[model samples]
Target: MGLVIPFDDKASDPGLEALVALVAADMNRVNQTILARTGSDVAMIPEVATHLISSGGKRLRPMLTLATAALCGYQGEGHVKLAAAVEFMHTATLLHDDVVDQSEMRRGKLAARLLWGNEASVLVGDFLLGQAFRMMVEVGSLACLDVLSVAATVIAEGEVMQLSAAKDTETTEDAYLAVIRGKTAELFAAAAEVGPIVANRPKAEVAACRAYGMNLGVAFQLIDDALDYGGQAAKLGKNVGDDFREGKITLPVVLSFRRGNETERAFWKRVLEKGDIAEGDLETALATMKKHRALEDTVERARHYGSMARDALELFPDSAPRRALLEAVDFCIGRAH
Candidate 1:
């Protein structure tokens, strides 16, 4: 079930909006940087890249970079370039993921791979990745570059780990966490940590920033996993059973599989491992998750990590940016509703 976050009867909380408001000016600069760097003489590069970039993603990771850097009293323009680099990296992953998954849709429209073909999609993704690294170098901070470069490698490893784990019913919660930590949290931690590093903050504060982003990223991905089963397709910008069809062993699937009986396990193996999904299979899967409270448990886990993210920010003094970042943790968990 979607977590019903009580927010004065509002459909959604104002936390992300508040965070966006706090970083509006900096975010504009980041957007400008992104647009400027994405251009290429080859028409297809800009076409594919701009199609995905113009999609209505919230750009949360880059905003985190800007907010964290400002929170650390950074006065340099490096944060803008770093924020743009973070966005490019995220976009690159999306392009690569769609191609690997053979997904038909992205952000409620035809995937670039579908429109432009897989080879173009992969090559454009590589172009974005190269541009992301070039921007990282322009920042001129070896520490920042180190963090993001390691994140890039970790993200690739995570994609591979997920590929291997797909359709494998034996995947554990710990293994799933490791996959998401690499696939999602590494960039978040690097994005946040780089802020403090660029600002020349102390080690402890930088560590705290990294901790905040890591926990927040975990919470973000956990909520996403929950929403795949509970969320509306329109809000999700894809079909509800996309994950099930792909046979990806997300947390809910893992929990349901582990708790299921022999008959249920057979059902999972038929549908997931063998990709023999038929009519009513998704409904059956939902019923199984509900029976075992898998979806609810997954959302609860997200709340736990969100709490950790908030707690990590305790090292920072009270300020508008800090409040927004704390609210972002709430927003990340709350969005599942």
Candidate 2:
């Protein structure tokens, strides 16, 4: 029998409203910092950067930094700068990712690469990384700087790893996990860890925040992978079959390919490996995933990580921030429905 995770009808909002309310003031500062930093004498730099930055994204990673700092009772302005830095790092990655993937859409708008050529997109992404590091240096916390800098390196490595594994039907689950850890979870971990570090929290609390963010990031990516196959385009901010069309080897593809029969495996090899996708290939892929319960099991795996994220916060006391953090996990996992 397949694993079954309960879906809550009320999880529609993913508890983000509470988190937004909790971090409202600090987030405003972060936003201001972002807008100020994006400006440049080279007009194209701001033009390209603003196009994507202004696009509709939840700003969840930076929000994680702010929320974690609040949870740790931080009263300094360092968290605001760090939050803005985290957002810059994330935006840089998206700009680079769209160029690498040749993706046409991001956050429900034309990808920056599409609007401003790939060269401009890549250059602007570099500019953002430069700004992100500047903010980190200004904070003057070597420990926080180390965490975010290491995350930036790891995120780049993860992207390279994914590039190597792209469209390889034989890619293992371990390989995929390693990729996500570097590309996605590392930033989340760093974003969450820097908060407690700046707040001068206990070592255990710092470790707990790191663990929570890492697990939450993994869960968030897993749900995104699942959503690529089963979610709506409007809700996903991209075409429903974008991953399929791109020949990206996400978890659902890995699971379904492994569980498929000889004929089905050949079908995957043809579309994913050989890039011979034809009409109805996406439908067939989705059907194959459903037949093997690949999407459902992928979500079950996400629930496992979500549980770990919640448990990571057990060391913290009961508070609004803690509650909001816990609810954020539910929101990540519940987006599948």
Candidate 3:
């Protein structure tokens, strides 16, 4: 459903064309290398990996890594390895995510779990995780190893936390944000920071870039959650209400609970705690959100993070990549699907 972003009125928005163009260039090159690496494996292990990798995705993480490298004036071959490494980590999590969520769809296609069975997907996901570490080692940087390893640990920790909090009304914005950082933003931070790490760039520049990526990553996920219900089913590539169907509580739902009245909340409790929602339960939940304006408020929060992300990049000198990175901040919020 997410693939069909609203672009017909592109002219209504200013400054988006250039950023999308630059980001697309980086993604195209990354995609080629990714296809080759995932395809070159001589066995089914590589073949399944290739199938999943070749399945369409936005490739946002790798693009962020490579773009930050270019912005930092990195002129090394190591950036490709770094980009691929970021992708491997992302794909690994995705493979596991589908199994955990018991999801059957991703990127508008049957999920790996559906195609190959959960066991195969789990083992292959492990392969990708191992492959990611291997790629990190190939870069030959202990610091990169430290950064990615720490991010991986935090990601697992966050996933556990989210699992514990999945349908509980007790989950807070603080807990939600923590889970989000671990699940989504930490890698963004690492991806952008790895550029400076590989380039041997200044420490302060590296730190700032990391901050930019982290904030943007958080904002990106926050907006992604909002889009789950608000986005067109075609744009989302899944059922419009999958998150609620899975009993996954997102920021919007979290905030809606906070904002809801007793009667409204009982509806949530029925759907969430009791898991007895009727067919139109999602529409009811969405109405509550609209009534509370939770979606608008969430979008505002995402924009605030995007602003911070762009400001973090101010420490670096201007370049096309830098400009593109800055524009991505706006795209994260302005997009509709």
Q: Residues 1-337, candidate 3, lDDT per residue (tens digit)? A: 3223232334233435665576576666666766666643447577668767877666778888888878777777777877888898899888888899998788777887888889888888888778778878888989988998998898888788889988887689998999999999999999889988888888998899899989999999888888886887655656777888889989889899999999988888889877887977888888898888777777778878888998998897788988888777777767642
- Would you give me the overall lDDT of model 1? 0.90
Residue lDDT tens for model 2, 139-169:
9999999999999999999999999999999
Ranking by lDDT: 2, 1, 3
Enumerate clash totals for all models, in the order shown.
0, 0, 7
Instruction: Give the higher-TM-score candidate: 1 or 3.
Output: 1
Residue 65 displacement in candidate 1 (angstroms) = 0.4
Off by over 4 Å in 3: 1-29, 39-42
Q: Give lDDT tens digits, candidate 1, residues 1-337.
A: 3323222223354558778998899999999988999899999999999999998899999999999998999999999999999999999999999999999888988899999999999999999999999998998999999999999999999999999999999999999999999999988998898899999999999999999999999999998898888887777787777899999899999999999999999999999999999988988998899888898889888889989999999998899989999989878887776
TM-score of 3: 0.92
Q: Give the deviation of candidate 2 from the true structure as CA RMSD.
A: 2.9
